[model samples]
Target: MRMKIAAAAAMALTAMPLSASADGEVNIYSYRQAYLLEPLLNAFEKETGIETNVVFAKQGLAERLEREGRNSPADVVMTVDISRVNELVERDLVAGVKTDTLTGNIPENLHHPEGKWYALTTRGRLIYVSKERVEEGEITTYEQLADDKWNDRICTRSGKHPYNIALISSMIAHHGEAETEEWLRGLKDNLARKPQGGDRDQIKAIAEGVCDVAIGNSYYYGNMLMDENQRPAAEKVNLIFPNADGRGTHVNISSISLTKSAPNRDEAIALMEFLTSPEAQRIYAEANTEYPANPGVKPTGLVAEWGEIHPDDLSLQEIANHREAAVKLVDRVDYDG
Candidate 1:
């Protein structure tokens, strides 16, 4: 319980600077909330005798790392979403790390080929339909979101959101830019309202009878179901794994990278390897209701209750490559409007 957690802003102003190479200590800059990481980090510390320090932020951790450069005390950076992790690589803030343990624990497609970053857990971009309105078999694929029959019945968060962007990127990977663009436009035309709020809001919209369908991540539904206030709304919708019979559902990940300037390199790598272990993977996955990236670890609790996920085999690298195109398609279609 010797963990130190600081808000990014507070750390900048008041905290004493850390040594570049502190013994038995690993520093982290994370976009993932501290609570979600607490159990995993605490476990790492107790077992390995390495103290953990974390600076948590919703935004700007990457830029902060860039600013601090080689002198930065950060060892490992943890964050969710493909675009964010790819941004770290694009900015040249992380170093390549390859190990037998890492390779054995993580799927090839879930980690960078060059070993710059590795995914810890995954969550699918799921379709949510009103239990009362949409038929179970009526909308089974993402392609059908554009169908005329569902016009004025669909709801979603902003298309430019990373989750939607990744989904669109996957679409571009599978169908090419032109076809993806057309699908985006058709989806835009089906919106029940201007894109607004988080994924949970889309589920709420369905509950309130504002729309019959929505797009959201699997964990959001699980989270909502766990909350008494939101469970009623969550219960109104059924989770649909789109394209389960074909290309499979598109999934995004929560990932970790070793900073280029990691002073605690050995401990950092140990932390990474430990995270992929069955014990840690189970803790990480269950904490957020996400699928474990370690293939040996199966999702439990509510996530397991949802059944198996056949994730789209399209490489995440390809999804990252198509992200710019997906953003362009979103803007081109005025999807937020």
Candidate 2:
């Protein structure tokens, strides 16, 4: 069923090969980091002789799409979070794509329900704790962070961070606002230092004994443990996947879609199909130190080394389904307030 969908999508949008120099030119508007996305783009260009041009930004890709509109030269819209995908959809800036390859590749949870966006890779939102301070097997759940026991021993990135927002949203998905609020209030009281810096900084603070535990997406840990500045933080911290009892770990995706008015619609579809194939998926995962959306693909070595985790099966639609409510709850709780 999945494979058939991808093939149909591939054929559906492709037109005359637009006789370019086969430079494999693909114009991508991405929110994913340039360093993480570049390796994959380079590899694709090398294999297909296509030139990959990227415009990387933290926000406002939608505005760019809107500005360009029907005359937009963009061939692909690639970025993170379900909210971003939904934004593209709401703007009518994305087109539906079907490819048996994509279907067989990405899980239904990671991809758009209506075939508009396909999750290319995923990151787990989990806990990071100080090895020297946090005893092994002491904390096992996200709710534990809200426990009074760890008060003043926890460090976190800013609540305003999207990752944190999505995490709070996930809690709403499972436990509702009132219950989540109680947890939030507890966590707020427990703040080690007012949620300063990025995920890496939280782990670093733990190493510095500023906190005993922290919450972060998995890749920061992967990067910290690998390429980032090393210290006790890199050495003394461990990662834990929480919420796996029934809801599974909170997982977020970096996905791709085609512009609704893409001038190079065929090129966009081709790029999308090529992306879901095994080769691109591998690069996508390895580069980002994330899990590939395809079930058949093993996580990159770093991820495999992180050990296996049961991810939340809730679809992008389901996770995204609660966005408005999640936003309201985040504001109501005054997470950053």
Candidate 3:
């Protein structure tokens, strides 16, 4: 499995490097996998007669663009996680863009205030509890993760991973840094094992009796259910949209940005607007099993079956602002150790 993933990453990287492009073409450097973005790109090309060229990599596109400077051929940068998109903006690899359509389609909190990036899709940070062990209504809030009764029953991925950091950042946003730090310490004490593995592994752990509950993103439940071998393990757990009754569920986005060096700025903007359109947003949600950034669009497939998500009203930019403090709290708790 590791070899296959490595080979896939290698093949994705070997795709042609972006270069100065023709009039009707837009070049993209994406951390998002090809399968995830191709449907949207294909639809854009078919509708507008503009070509889309892509070079995919899991990391380092920001540094590469920094090195290439003004000569970089990337017109758009696409990636998952706000931290990554924020990194591009911080490095000055992305340029702020504004359009009436874009501004109208995305919520204020979901996009950068300066328009440097826009969220394409979102997913909730939810809890999954073993169906056999945890009863309905037994747990309902992020604050409960730290409750003493749950000691030795909780599981999580590394606290340093962007997903957890984002969740922790939200904690910092709602509670002050000091209170969040205390919560982290208590949450750490509840762990079934030292924080390890991806979200899916946590679900798998619940099935194996390694733990009774786990924290993970909502879409991963869809992914696990889609796999034949993973479905049983997925069925062993039930999802809880934490904090639904209070601040609403914490959510994170997969984002897109306009590059500072865009040579095909017009065409790139066209594609960007196309992605925000209801039609393309629906297609994206259907293909990825994630919530559309455009509220007018509805999710399909298993994600739709999971039910409507009430996203936390807190500003994501503010949450991003607290990320550094969140990381410090994680270290202070020795969360992964």
Candidate 4:
């Protein structure tokens, strides 16, 4: 019966309009790459016999979904960063979902108050310092990036980037807007070079001795170590979970949402629930060297070797709320200049 339902769903997907939702099929529009999601999707298919379809893009997915409106074929939307996911909520593009499985598997701080979205995995905003040039305890907090001892020693990507914006937003939540502005000015004054590249480039800059410390996501360091060509550079730096002993490291998430126009709501919910399962969480996190959002699932492989992370308890929504201020502060300080 399951196989018959699955086959029928697959055929319906092929024959019907994109907006048609079938009983045993789920459709996903994702900003995350296809390769990362394949394993988890495959497992979901095998277990529940639901057919899955995915459209992967780097940008414009939110716009696409907005244009499609009620006819949109997207049942689930997946992407990284709080700002992107929050955009779905702000635009009313995604509907809230409440299920015991989802709420139970994910933590309170990680999900929306009304369940508009749920995070699947998290990556820390890490500090990477040249292992040889910087000594232990030399730099231990995000606040230290502003200290005079590190003037012309720090490297980072554009402050306007969503990742940095989210981090800056967290700072505002902890400190008032006035104090965060001062901190931003200090951090900007300390830049080794005009912030010009992605997180990986900052790591590479460290390897080339262009800077002594860089701000980056934890997964990039792990991914670089896994690549033979990048391994040498990666090995040159030590990863720091800043503020670990105090407020804990700031972490960003990769998350999923149920589109307001979900054609196959049941199948979509099934897939969402499956993703939070221990089996799916393990496969999902290990694929990209990320920490599982499901706290019961432990980090493995190279991610585990880096040691445990104590994530900041600040609510992601609180961080999202301050995004505009963070961007303004970045520009006000001329951080990229």
Per-candidate TM vs. native? 0.97, 0.88, 0.95, 0.94
Clashing residue pairs in candidate 3 (N, C-alpha, C atoms within 3 angstroms): none
Name the regions of candidate 4 deviating beyond 4 angstroms.
1-19
- Best-performing candidate as measured by TM-score: 1
lDDT of 4 by residue, 186-275 (tens): 998889999998999999999999999999999999999999999999999999999999999999999999999998999999999999
In terms of lDDT, the poorest run of 10 residues in model 1 is 8-17
**Model 4 has how many clashing residue pairs?**
0
Instruction: Report how far residue 196 has shifted in candidate 4, in Å.
Output: 1.2
Candidate 1 regions exceeding 4 Å error are 8-19
The global Cα lDDT (0 to 1) of model 1 is 0.92
Encode model 1's per-residue lDDT on 115-231: one tens digit a residue. Answer: 999999999999999999998899999999999998999999889988899999999999999999999999999988999999999999999999999999999999999999999
TM-score (C-alpha) between model 4 and the true structure: 0.94
Error of 1 at 139 (Å): 0.6
Checking candidate 1 for backbone clashes, the offending pairs are none
* Backbone N/Cα/C clashes per model: 0, 14, 0, 0
- The true-versus-predicted C-alpha distance at residue 16 of model 1, in Å, is 6.9
Instruction: Provide the overall lDDT of each model, using Cα atoms, as 2-decimal numbers.
Output: 0.92, 0.76, 0.87, 0.90
